[model samples]
Target: MGSAVLDIGGNTGALVVVTGPEWSGREIEISTKDQDPLARTRAAVRARHTGAGTRYTAVFPTLPAGPYVIWRTATEPAGTVVVAGASVTEIEWWQLP
Candidate 1:
């Protein structure tokens, strides 16, 4: 999962999904104080993934909150790779059923 820091004044969020060979589906969940566009997007991603039975979550820092994005990719021959920018907080990998 990958998360990006958002602009404090910004009010939009986005979620991304990438399906892989072993991945059947994904579930993502987000919690926020308000129903901002970004927050809603995060929630939607969570709902979709939850409905599919996958588990995912990405959280950003304060001030801007976040413009977080999450993705799932098929296991690569070289294994998984994660790249983060300066605004990123954490990145994780999981083996799916």
Candidate 2:
């Protein structure tokens, strides 16, 4: 699971990603709010291995207000997070059989 905050101050927020008990230290990516030409060419926001078991945290220190996509790789299963001003949006990922 992961989260991002929406604020007008351009402050960074924390995102916690949880794959499962079997997976740890997985590299995950996040997208910025709204659509920008630079957004596609820009690097995907990456989550770091928290070293806290199966949890990864990605922090955007200067994130603009909008919705962001939190995913493992592709946009599918892309958890949509809406920031309404300094609020934490918790998102989770899963694998289906």
Candidate 3:
């Protein structure tokens, strides 16, 4: 986390997606909201064995500035994100309902 504010009109930024504790071994994806995605990243990491994780975190760097969403499989439990230049936007969601 930094002190810089989001530059809404700038070209790119970062997105951090955090999932609920029980989301181990699941695949998470990011897509531009209402817009076709320019790219997608596959996130797979488990935080269950430690027995103390608050959430599973996924970081997407240099994403185009705009609205996006985090989804797993069918996208039911998705959370939204906004990436503004040089800043990081966070989206937190629980396991699929």
- Residue 46 of model 2 has an lDDT of 41
Q: Please give me the total number of clashing residue pairs in predicted model 2.
A: 7
- Count of backbone collisions in candidate 1: 9
Better of 2 and 3 by TM-score: 3
Where is model 3 more than 4 Å wrong at Cα?
A: 1-10, 37-40, 45-55, 75-77, 95-97
Clashes of each: 9, 7, 0
- The local distance difference test score of each candidate is 0.34, 0.47, 0.60
Q: Which prediction has the highest TM-score against the true structure?
A: 3
Better of 1 and 3 by TM-score: 3
For model 2, the superposed segments whose C-alpha errors exceed 4 Å read: 1-12, 36-62, 75-77, 95-97
TM-score for all models, in order of appearance: 0.23, 0.46, 0.59
Per-residue alpha-carbon lDDT of candidate 1 for residues 7-85, written as tens digits (9 for 90 to 100) = 4334432323333324333443333333342442222222124445654443333323443323232211212222233
Whose lDDT is higher: candidate 1's or candidate 3's?
A: 3
| Preferred candidate (TM-score higher): 1 or 2 | 2
TM-score result, candidate 3? 0.59
Clashing residue pairs in candidate 3 (N, C-alpha, C atoms within 3 angstroms): none
